[model samples]
Target: MTLYKIDEVASECNLTKRTIRYYEEIGLLSPQRSEGNTRLYTREDIERLKKIISARDVLGFSLQELHRYIEVVEMLTGQRERYRSITDLEERRRQLEEIDDTLGKQLDMMESKMRTIQSFKEEAEQLRQQVREGMERLGRQSVERAEAEH
Candidate 1:
């Protein structure tokens, strides 16, 4: 197995050495050690780090949640590799379907909210125009009356 120094791994992943070490300390990664106590990372380790960071920052998962997902992925990988479990595949498919459904619902809700806001803005604009017209009419009437009285 080819070993990568901390700098090499950081450069490959576009993250700082401190961040990588912190992730390892926090149980997010488990890079192997060489004979000289150097950290050696496999391709799988890099992929896992990518997943962890993306899940936390992009998908808004907490560290604990991301850790759980990493464990799940690891377990699924093992099961698929060793046992070739069809049930695990089916479960993953179901989970993805549920995620799609939830995302669709959220999109619908956001669209509804946007429509409501647009309607309110239109109504407010119409009311403001009416108020302006009413004021102008009242001012003209008052001026004519004053002139006639004078």
Candidate 2:
């Protein structure tokens, strides 16, 4: 049950203290408070912040999207816990369905981001192709001018 201060947590997570506080302000994190109203972070809180960082920086999720992603992940975690405790066949089936639904939401968000990245790549390739064509055209005109001069 190790507790960490905000500075320690930020350094461990490679984030600024203000960024960590901002995440808390946006409901993405909720570290416990100390007796003096200072924010105290647990190992779990640090882990959650790492996930938030990954979602925002690696996955390029906007704040709104990150909120939804965290909500789905939390729901799935709870559903998994409930699933292990349930014994009835119907209840287990329902739990599985809920888990699947949560997973689908996450997958949808990832797919949308992938599509956007792919679109950007395609546009970049088109621009590169146009540049290549323009260069080739210029080279041909240069040769033609030299020939005409000669």
TM-score each candidate: 0.54, 0.94
Task: Give me the displacement of residue 23 in model 1, in angstroms.
Answer: 0.9
lDDT of 1: 0.76
Off by over 4 Å in 1: 83-150
> Residues 1-150, candidate 1, lDDT per residue (tens digit)?
666778888998899999999999999999998888888888888888988887666555667767766766675555444443345877767655655655565455446656776899899999999999999999999999999999
User: 1-150, model 2: which lDDT tens digit per residue?
Assistant: 889999999899999999999989989999899999999999989988888889999889999999998998888889999999999999999999989988998999999998998999999999999999999999999999999999
| Collision pairs in model 1 | none
Worst 10 residues of 1 by lDDT: 78-87
As a whole number from 0 to 100, the lDDT of residue 146 in candidate 2 is 98
Give per-residue lDDT, candidate 1, residue 116: 72
